[model samples]
Target chain A: MDNQYIEEAYKEGFTVRFAVKKRLFSEQSEFQKVEIVESTHHGKMLFNDGAAMVSERDEAIYHEMIAHVPLLVHPNPQKVLVIGGGDGGTAREVLRHDSVKECVMVEIDSSVVEGSREFIPKTSCVFTNPRLRLTIGDGVAFMAETKEKFDVILVDSTDPVGPAQPLFGPEFYGNVFRCLNDNGIVVAQGETPFYEPEAQRSLVGIMGKFFAVVRPYNFTNMTYPGGLWSFIFASKGLDPIRDVRVGAEQKLGDFFYYNPDIHRASFSLPTFMRKNLSGLLRDK
Target chain B: MDNQYIEEAYKEGFTVRFAVKKRLFSEQSEFQKVEIVESTHHGKMLFNDGAAMVSERDEAIYHEMIAHVPLLVHPNPQKVLVIGGGDGGTAREVLRHDSVKECVMVEIDSSVVEGSREFIPKTSCVFTNPRLRLTIGDGVAFMAETKEKFDVILVDSTDPVGPAQPLFGPEFYGNVFRCLNDNGIVVAQGETPFYEPEAQRSLVGIMGKFFAVVRPYNFTNMTYPGGLWSFIFASKGLDPIRDVRVGAEQKLGDFFYYNPDIHRASFSLPTFMRKNLSGLLRDK
Candidate 1:
């Protein structure tokens, strides 16, 4: 099985291949195709719509980065909300913060959660956390109707395609903006700026219109398209740079990637990205 | 050949595959096997002994990072020396600086220079520069005998395997140290820390013993395994952080992946890396 590899057609002409050890499970849910495969390079992996989402090997980097960046920014984030993180990894990282009283994860697809729990249990095990409330519904609709406001809202959607396409729209960001308190924060998984430039540009463009402090940061995620992946943080009031500090909880334990230095370092954009950003922000 | 993809075994169990368009050239040189292939995703690619070295698309990132970081650190970099960068991308980038009076490239393999000049003409055309002197010989031996000191020595070597293994030793580093001027700087391609932790640790360890300031930084090279790739900078006097500036040449044109903020940001290691570095530096 060393030669037998699963290739993901990420962009039109680009693809990333991973050697598969075995196919644990594969099924098409009502929303999208879900699969769990153990790979020779990465550990147990979960795929939604044939796109690699989370792998047990480097899941900590993505999960810790998404949850901690904003959580650390807000001085006191009592309540948090996560949209489209069906794999439960985001919820797990969110639970690490002692300041968070409640974490509600609204995932549109129920099968992704079931498959993740069954196949990629390492990241999906957060379902048992007492503070977590898993809500199976459209994240946009949930955010629009919710009366409660959050200190941080992490939009851990898949790439802007199929069920996740709506998550990147103006309406969705508007809903997220309305669902946040003053000095609240929202961090969304911006697509690869290199491979998926349209997705990255459009998301950052839209987010810039609403938030006072709109910043994007990047980290290497091997499971993703270009390996170089981006994430956007939009704050209503708090600035990620000035407000964020090295929290005690973050210093102690399970996080293998995110730290105080990385939290700051991730904001530095390379020249190509700087060019894209300089042009994009100037237009906005 | 849309479906035809060439895969390189980067490590014992890990591999990275690139969509191939055509096989440009293949030959067994005196030092190593050299191949030039056009890829569907990455324009043109050069490989040595079945290991991917550079691709046209993201080669600027690697080339700019290795050359500009040190070139910019030196107040006035007039004399520059590059070892093992037969692809000529390093020379091309180094020549971008206006202050460079002489750019000497010491390549161990004459065939690599020939192949790169013939096949990768876009990056290799720097050979035509009046100030450039291409020396085809063993870089280790050349550095040991050469009395000409340089402001910066950019080592753009392949993985420390086969012919390139000797370049990573202490004696070779000592030669590089002696070949550099009083305020000299040397930046080496220090393998992938995530995948080749032993290589990264040893290289950093060896350099620390010789240089007054030693720093290891990493960036995403999609062509490389682990996505995370490391580079070590050893300076006799100047600190890359305190001394390096975004120069006029870097800001003018052609550079796609390096900038002032990135220069500072590159030194900020991630937590996983910080842990490895912290403990390793302490032991030394």
Candidate 2:
């Protein structure tokens, strides 16, 4: 069979093309279209509704960043909640922290979990860890009804479209705020600033109304549309920078991206982003 | 007419496509292939040998970073040299500092200058400035023969292939060291760490032999191959982070990306880059 090229058009004019060695599996799940392909550039990759989600080569940067930053901020995060991370990458990083006694992952689509578990084992291997409890259900519905609180809640959903649309609005953030401890922190993927500044502004503005400290940090994701991606960090009372323990990153054995220096430096936004998100970011 | 899309494959497996509204100009220059196209996503873009050089939409991030960081690190950069920035974007930024008495820009290709001057005048408009003296010649030859010393040198060459290959070797750096003052600094485009770790390690390793302080910092360039790009900072006796004047960025009236926080944050490389470049970086 001839090698195929998969092109993802980010917008009208820009696109990224990945050469695939083979298409392992493809299915139209209830939530979205889940795909698994062996790519020459990115290793085995998983896609949700035609959007690249995780790949073996570059998943560490996105996973390590989302999990380590907030885990380092909270003094002792014994309990954690992860929403919509069916690929198990987020759960893998969350379980890395020894302080966490239990990690509850509620992913809406069972196909993503099943596909990732078999296709992308590097990230999905953590699904079998003893500390993890997997639940196949809607993340938004679970957030609204859960009486339990978490020290850190990671909202690792797809783009703010289709099933992930509610995750970016005020209702979801209000429920997230209600279910967090006084010193809790929630970090969510806030889209790319280059192409989605308006989405970022609205996300930050909604979170700022609920959390005392809301700041967006940056990381480079090659598979994403604009190369640069942001994660919104919202807290009840603790600051992501000041509250972080100095030597906490050493505890995470080997990280591809996140470190103590990077944890702090990631908060520095470019002047353009800072200007566009002026009133939304609550640094204090 | 149907919209034409131009695709540049960074490697065998990865590529980026840009939608072109019209082909403004195309020619085979003496040094390389010079092309200008009006892009829907990037505004007017200049491509050299099929590689995207600078886009009007995102030129500020790359140009401001290459110019302002070293300028702020040195106490007073009176005389500066820029090599291979034929688009004049680098000189536009270099002239922003009022302390710059003379800015010498040496570009090997006149076609690039002429085409950019006509099609992308937003950046090429700086060629009319009195402080900048444009020279058309081989940058390696100019560095080897220049009798005058500069307070700062900016090597804004293309990729390590083609006619720009000589700019990345040890000989060019040796001459750059010889032409710098006691506290002079040199910042060179050191390729992206994601796709060119070997090039980065080699560049940092070579500069380590010449300067007391040699470090590589990163910035995100979406037009580039891997979304992430790096610039190597080398100095005779100055530390880029500590020697930078506090609040000096205020003097530069308005900037799109360069700031004091960004200047400090850019040096914090990821864990993988740090491990790969372990002994090559001389922080002291």
Q: Write the per-residue lDDT of candidate 2 for residues B180-226, one digit (tens) a residue.
A: 99999999998988888998899899999899999888888778877
Question: What shift in Å separates residue A32 of candidate 1 from its native position after superposition?
Answer: 1.7
**TM-score of the first chain alone, every candidate:** 0.94, 0.98
Write candidate 1's Cα lDDT for A1-284 as tens digits: 23366667755456566778898878888888888889887898888877889888889889998998898888888899999889999999998888899999999888889888888878889999999999999887887788998989999999887888889999988888988999789999987877777778888889887888788998886678667888898988777777776566445475688878778889888877877776454211
How far is A241's C-alpha from truth in model 2 (Å)? Answer: 0.9
Q: Give the lowest summed-lDDT range of ten residues in model 2 chain A.
A: A1-10
Model 2 residue A27 lDDT?
A: 93
**DockQ of every predicted complex:** 0.61, 0.79
Residues B37-102, candidate 1: write the lDDT tens digits: 898878888989888888888888888889888888899899999998999999999998889999
Task: Work out the TM-score per prediction.
Answer: 0.95, 0.98
Whole-model lDDT for model 1 versus the true structure? Answer: 0.83
Clashing pairs in 1: none
Per-residue lDDT, model 1, residue B57, is 85
TM-score of chain A of 1: 0.94
Off by over 4 Å in 2: A1-3, B1-3
True contacts kept of each: 0.56, 0.77
How high is the CA lDDT of each candidate model? 0.83, 0.91
Candidate 2's residue-wise lDDT over A1-284, tens digit each?
A: 13587767778588778899999889998889898999997899888877889878889999999999999989999999999989999999999999999999999999999998888899899988999999999988999999999999999989999999999999999999999998899999989888888999999999999998999999996788778899999999889899898887787799998888889899999999999998778866
